[model samples]
Target: MDIKVLGPGCPKCHETERLVKEVVAELSVDASVDKITDLMKIAGYGVFGTPAVVVDGEVKSVGKIPKKEEIKTWIEG
Candidate 1:
């Protein structure tokens, strides 16, 4: 699984990144978690919001912080 957390290094962005990493580690999922802090790169994903979560190139969540269960569902999907 490929997980990308997009933000411009805001507090929520950092929290989202930490949450994703925590969930991945807890579940032992074989995934690469990357943080996209570049504005151009984030926009390239067609996400107009900060603190977005992209799983496997799909925009799972955008503009707000998602719940842990929501993230797990996306990863497990």
Candidate 2:
């Protein structure tokens, strides 16, 4: 699975990345996580908010640090 965290290196963004890693580890899922910091690239995802989570090329959540359970659902779903 492919996951992308889109943000400008803010605290929330960092938290999201960390949580994503935790979720991936806990789930034992093989996935790639990429931090997208470039403004232009982030905009291409149609997300104006920071700390967005994208899974498998689909935007999962944006503008907030989602809970671990929610992230796990997204990852597994």
Candidate 3:
């Protein structure tokens, strides 16, 4: 699985990225987690909000720090 966390390195963005990595590690899912910070790249995903989560090229969350349970559901689903 491919997961991308889009942000420009804000605190919320950092927390979001951290939570994503934590969940991925705990689940032991074979996935690549990437942080996309470039404005053009983030826009390419059609996400105007920072701290967006994209899984398998699909937008899952945007503009908020999703809870741990939410993150887990995204990973599992």
Global lDDT of each model?
Answer: 0.93, 0.95, 0.95
Tens digits of per-residue lDDT for model 2 on 1-77?
Answer: 99999998999999999999999999999999999999999999998698999999999998999999999999889
Task: lDDT for model 1, please.
Answer: 0.93
Residue pairs clashing, model 3: none
Instruction: State which candidate, 1 or 2, has the greater TM-score.
Output: 2
Considering lDDT, which of the candidate structures 1 and 3 is the better prediction for this target? 3
Question: How many backbone clashes can be found in candidate 3?
Answer: 0
For residues 9-48, write the lDDT of model 1, one tens digit per residue.
9999999999999999989999999999989999999987
| Top-TM-score structure, candidate number | 2
lDDT of 3: 0.95
Q: Candidate 3, residues 1-77: lDDT per residue as tens digits?
A: 99999999999999999999999999999999999999999999998699999999899999999999998998999
Runs in model 1 deviating more than 4 A are: none
- Badly placed stretches (over 4 Å) of model 3 are none
